[model samples]
Target: MNIEIKVAKKSFNYSGPKNWEETEPWLYAKIFGIGKQLAEKPHALFALPQMIFQIPTNVLQFLFDRNAMRMVGVKDEEAQDEVMGQGYALLKIAQSFANSEAPFSWKVPKVKAAFLGYNYYGPGDSLGMLTFEEFWFAEAAYERNDTNALIAVLYRRDPYRKQTFSEELTEKTLKDLQALPELTKEMIVFNYQGCRLGFSKKFKHVFPKKSVEKDDEQQPKKTKKNSGGWLQVAIGMAGDSSVEFDALRKLNVIVALQMVENKLIKVKQLKRKTK
Candidate 1:
């Protein structure tokens, strides 16, 4: 199948997977929280029956280690030796449409997927909708053909302008969008991937919530500076010094994903999950 993926080594402002514990509290309380959302939404849908056998701690270590190597000089320095760093792989894609009407799924395969904007046709204008070049929005905007899923809207909002995407091909695709009169084919497609979360070695949380007032001026920045994964480790290390505490977690990743599906969480949910 044609999937237009827009992957970055760092996206949603994190270099890699989210910290686990940040996700634990809600996952533990909500879906797994005894008569919470999950139990209510999914009564008959059986879990895929995969019980935890073992989690290779080594793999976890590999995924969470602070890829501490430093790089500052140009290419060909002795310290520029190729070394295996620590981190996990995250792959994602966005979809775009010519007419902005069709719905598409973001599941890699069979997993339950999250829904995107509803009534998203932004303030009626020449352009029917508007969205930032965020990852989830990109995935939610994906367009499909017989062989490939194409994404091009991000390129529209690019630091570098690559193409105008006005072609017969684009016009044909938007023909399926019943929202407006036929548009000239202006859709271009692209995919992104293979990014590593390796750039936050010397940063710290500059702003804490308590210090900042909750007003327009006091509003936290739209994005964070570090690959929030570190914050996750800090959170996990808070109460317990051992894996026992982690294992004691009542809610799992699946439940969290389900909660997201059920409209139970808000913005904080995406920025606060562990791999």
Candidate 2:
């Protein structure tokens, strides 16, 4: 949304984000960085105008001060109050935009001509079509907090067809993604997180929740040894066959997860029978 204010024969126009979908990634970063400061210091509210509008510091100071308003021919108290009210209204709008929660919509917008005249597209709204390899690499990238890598994994040159995963292609695509606008990167991240959330909900059994108990004060806690991570899981699924592993990775994520769940259930059943 755009708002324009005319004061002392000069016009100042500013635009604020209406929602997460419309917000730039850099702006979101700024808002997140200042969130704690905004909470702790009421004076930090003045920073909002600068962030949202890119307003000059001197202009902001002049606009924020009542004495400055008087010097600029806004001597009438009522007029000054009205101008201040507009400023306050703009601040409120900005704050609300920053504070609003993002809706869970796993719809990633397409990036046209990202590289080699190929339009890159994300998995569908629920990521139902994502292959196991794609999901694995994307999840890994997300864990590492590597946005470029995540985007390269999630988006593909073909929208209607599945493509084989290629390290060379992914490397080249990552460079392309880095060159794109920050807003595009932000949107992709937002959609990717939403997709991940949906995937977790859909595969709740695969991601069983573990409750951690607090350690005793007098005794040191015994830490559990780490099991092998995704690499181990992939090896187990492949059963020492490289071809089988490649095929498994190409399987749809939902199907692969179901296979895992079924195997786990069978393992439990066998244990019960033995007992």
Candidate 3:
């Protein structure tokens, strides 16, 4: 099955503190680097928990058109068989990207081509506050979820600008964020602890109900087979705050996803007992 995907370019006019460009140019560049990396190897973004998750807009358009063809009986018999196959094909592609850590039986070539086809600009077309928060605090975001880590960096940038949120929920969140310690070099690393704790509190709302499991809340139960086995092996002896540690983390995640795509390792699965 062949499907064409096109994404329109959208600009997010970041209006962060003006001093950031002068004081932390690396952080500024890293934000752009992150977007480029995602475009090149989307499995990196897929491995991490997003603030929001949904079917990519371009993929959804394909699904809708496939269904529309079925209703119209365009090509009649061919459409019936091809449309069914295309649906499965779409699912396989989405699954590979969505379950980034899970083992896969096969690598769908077209899905891979689709992922790499477009240049992504800051989590393009997806509705999430992830890029907003990450771009706002690139350096510290490495070890933390963007949402909670936002306060620490934003506070350092401009405390008064934080008050300009017109959204009621955001306005309320800012009031709560004041409880965190003032941003410092030491606090950059330490603040991640709070960011993690905050995600734990909010996971129920952010992730789907079916995705979360009773035994493990960290990742979806379906993809827990490999767990962090390879990741640990990939980044040994690297300190959390070091540049090497961050690079290895991204590399390993991509490697693991590739291993899954190529069917290199056996994924653990629960055995079914015969009734």
Q: TM-score for all predictions?
A: 0.17, 0.57, 0.23
Q: Over the stretch 1-275, how does candidate 3's per-residue lDDT look in tens digits?
A: 12333222221111222111121323323332333356678654432211112235443443336554544444455544555464455445434433332111111111111223421111111112232223223334443655444433333222223333223533444454544333222233232333333333433222212333544555545533333432343344344657866544334222333433233222222222322
The residue-by-residue lDDT of candidate 2 on 1-275, one tens digit each, is: 78787677888887776655455646655654565477688677778767777777756665568998888889988888877887787678767866665524444446765445667776765566678878888889998999989888777777754557887878967876677676567767766776666555665545554434457675545544444434456559789798999899888887887777666567668999999
Question: Backbone clash tally for model 1?
Answer: 18
Best-to-worst order by lDDT is 2, 3, 1
lDDT of 2: 0.70
RMSD of each: 25.6, 7.7, 19.4
Give the Cα-based TM-score of candidate 1 against the true structure: 0.17
Candidate number of the best TM-score: 2
lDDT per model vs. reference: 0.24, 0.70, 0.33
lDDT of 1 by residue, 1-275 (tens): 12111112311122211221122222212212222223465431121110011123432232223232232221332322322221212111101111122111110111111132221111111111222112223334442331121232322222222322343423433332323211111111111110001111112121122232355777765544344432243334335655643432222322322333333233346557742
Q: Between which residue pairs do clashes occur in model 2?
A: none
Off by over 4 Å in 1: 1-40, 50-164, 176-275
Q: Which stretches of candidate 2 lie over 4 Å from their true place?
A: 1-105, 113-118, 217-231
Supply the global lDDT for candidate 3: 0.33
lDDT of 1: 0.24
